[model samples]
Target: MTDTTDPRHAHREEGFPAQQQDQPGLTDETRPDPDHGESTYRGHGRLQGRRALITGGDSGIGRAVAIAYAREGADVAIVHLPEEQKDADDTLALVRAEGRTALSLAGDVRDEDFATRVVTETRSALGGLDILVLNAAYQHDIDGFESLSTERMRRVFDTNLIGMLFTARAAFPHLEPGASMIVTASVQAYQPSPGLIDYAMTKAAQVAFVKALAEEAGPRGVRVNAVAPGPIWTPLIPATGWDAERLATFGEDTPLGRAGQPSELAGAYVYLASDDASYTSGAVLPVTGGKHL
Candidate 1:
């Protein structure tokens, strides 16, 4: 009998070392670099000849999806902040390793012009766009909801919602029948966390975005969906300004008793982006390690 890896121990199950980084953390700065499925994923042309654009694709969950998409035969274009140049290069290299076209676009998604430009750039560079992954986001723990300043709140809202809207709006006109748009939502949307209340608001809004857009795009043959993840270990986690103790025990409360790695999310994204999920749309597929959505 083929030995199937136990889900409970599929990836790192231990607590993380206490650490932190400035916002938009780089992969190298992360204590244990996230797994982007470099050596493990094997694709069978699920996305052959497809073109995709992933925001925040320099590292973390975005990078994982980029790797999986490339292996599945999709040419990829990744949008990221200029500070993530190093990580972007690394992701580009991995995609090119699969002989897929890789384009690195550096810009802040918070800028509406840039967000719109990325879709244009991806379409131009990749010849056409078939997939758009709205995965860019920002989150900082709030000590007290009363102290949530307008500036910080705006940053979270702009990055998580406005930026996503800008990109999606720009891509809609270009999207043809059969194209797909996937949002990277969070479990916090359903089960709100006091510390991440603002972030949760945006994620919940994303669910509405997916559902409402699905209705509008369905007739056009385009699909809109979301993937709500649990406590996945990514650069975003270290950069969330959590206390060392909190960082160490992150995601341990989950049913799996461990944090998820970026690699683990690759399959969910690949399925949603591929023809395998042809009939799936307006759905929020949860990758939360058994966490109830």
Candidate 2:
């Protein structure tokens, strides 16, 4: 799988199927299924006694991280929308199956005030927060600037950028030097798609925030970083409103020849959260199937 040239092609023969759904797409409906490492991920107790809070943990990269964290011996609290309860339940079951504590909190990240509340509730539920994963985001494709609406732009900025700021700030009081904050950035931040201008802006802003926050939070031993993914197949894709053709051939242009699976991404977060990454701060790790950052 590390060959970086479609080593996962056996799984890619099916490709990431072309599909569409309303915002916050459901995982059960996604074709070929997304691999969250359920039967494959083996734990090594890397995160024993750690407590974490991950946004959008009901599915996609967030869900994969949640499963990996729990298997690594960390208790987890996942924040998701009320409408995503079904998916949340599935994730919760997997965590508890690992003998790790799990909490599913429902709320909208764009609520502004909800960010602090989400952190507060997670800390209280898990006893403390050493790992904060700001993995939730909002994105949509547009034909061009003309199709981009002020409302859509505002929603994107509010959810993708403002929410990260609010959640990270709220978790500071609960974090110590060994704590890690991992934001879910995108390669799109560095290589912008004309159709994704607004979404890309927020992602680039996230990279800047990570660098600055790492410096400021260093004295306290709290590291800030981000994972920039390329075309990983997740519910977010179809939910982003991509057309049929774009959806069908997604990630084929990458050197890998196909999109990445969610399972392929869990290790980066695990490393960042574990003591293994003690000195790794303010770095943006790209997991784009060999795509350049």
Candidate 3:
């Protein structure tokens, strides 16, 4: 007898069904009301007067955070890859629509020199930086370790980890008391998957980096934190080659039974970058639907 199951389909059987969860009304399309006075949220002025620079701010969780920060009264500088200029422009539009200043910069985070330039330009354009969000990442899956090429593995580490370090180093001097640094980690950091070994390893490094850097920067009143998001519905999914069925079933295996949306995790970033989390440092906040909890 011959087997007919697709290699991709084989993985689907290991996961559960997707569940539907009701989400809050805010979205990319909703216009922010300036005079609403934080009535829309339980917290007010969490990041007031703060100036933030967010890498990968063109889309996904980055875009969501940019909008949320503006609503909370912060100016934003969004850094994006060259190929994502349109998304960057859209994000800037949303920030301006929120009645806050927005700067859109295009470059790759993998280059240390470019990372430094981004920091300089952002400060000149935004006046200064109080919060830094290192949210950019890249990954490509391989079936087995033997099949993974050195080039692919290097690219994964360069984007997910090395670039993050460069961004942080470049922004360190500009960050002062009450400022915060937030990095986007993933659930795979704690719960590894064979197919995404390289990506998972880099995420694990990010968790470690956050803790170590927090201690080093604590004396200066700068806080460092990370957000470990589980499967979320982002463009990276379809762009990375997931089929309709696989994409539809994304995040189903977790206890929540559904993938989270980008908007769902934005508040956590806002809180970490705000004064409300003053005593919170060297911590990793898992937005993973109770996974590994």
Candidate 4:
């Protein structure tokens, strides 16, 4: 690859220390700092008066979306695991800094009851649910088929797929006409990474679910869509069981020869969640820095 990256933000090495965190990572401790639009995002009221709930909004792409949505004038609620309180607090602060209503709700999507409670509380607190960003995911890599334990596989499916199903079902009742449901699928869905079979399967299933939901929800004036991103610099990358070498050169194989920043993806999310995309549904918007779907 020629590395034809822009200079000011050229494809230089992302300055993150080669290290890993627990299953769901934290943003504050990351080196080189994954940009979550903290300093530079400029919004123009695309989502004015909207109310939204985002899962995994404690950090990374979810945090970026929350920040962008708040800047665009939406009341936002974010869901995170109890252990991720610090990241959730940071996300809440960032949203509040935009002078918008912000709430941080902590719960595990793996529990159906918890998902329902989160949705109900979000609607009550935020007034109503105009947008749903289902982005929380679990990915623990295995060497191959043999190393994959059955217990691990089931856990992945529960957290990554069944949880989404539960949350979406709970949120559907609160979603009114002209609402939007944007999911976070991934390039791994179409690309199918061998080591990440469980994660990839859930991602591919999400794309299909979105297309089906778009059809089912269209008559109700609700739009369903997804974003499939290539390698992006985020806390999750470090926690995904990659070795130090792979972690050091993450996203280098992409045509852009660099990993994407979480902030870089905020625009696609904002557009999909905004009225500007009222006619856009059942689409997978790929922000892969030149990678094809």
In the range 232-272, model 2's lDDT, one tens digit per residue, is 88888888888878888888878778888899899999999
Residue 227, candidate 4: Cα error in Å is 0.5
| TM-score head-to-head 1 vs 2, winner | 1
Write the residue-wise lDDT of candidate 1 on 234-269 in tens digits.
998989999989988988989988889999999999
TM-score of every model versus the real structure: 0.99, 0.96, 0.85, 0.95
Question: How many backbone clashes are present in model 4?
Answer: 0
Q: How accurate is candidate 2 locally (lDDT)?
A: 0.90
Best-to-worst order by lDDT is 1, 2, 4, 3
Residues 58-81 of candidate 4: C-alpha lDDT, one tens digit per residue: 999999999999999998999999
- How large is the C-alpha RMSD of every model relative to the true structure? 0.8, 2.0, 9.9, 2.8
Between candidates 1 and 2, the lDDT winner? 1
Which ten-residue region of model 1 has the weakest summed lDDT? 11-20
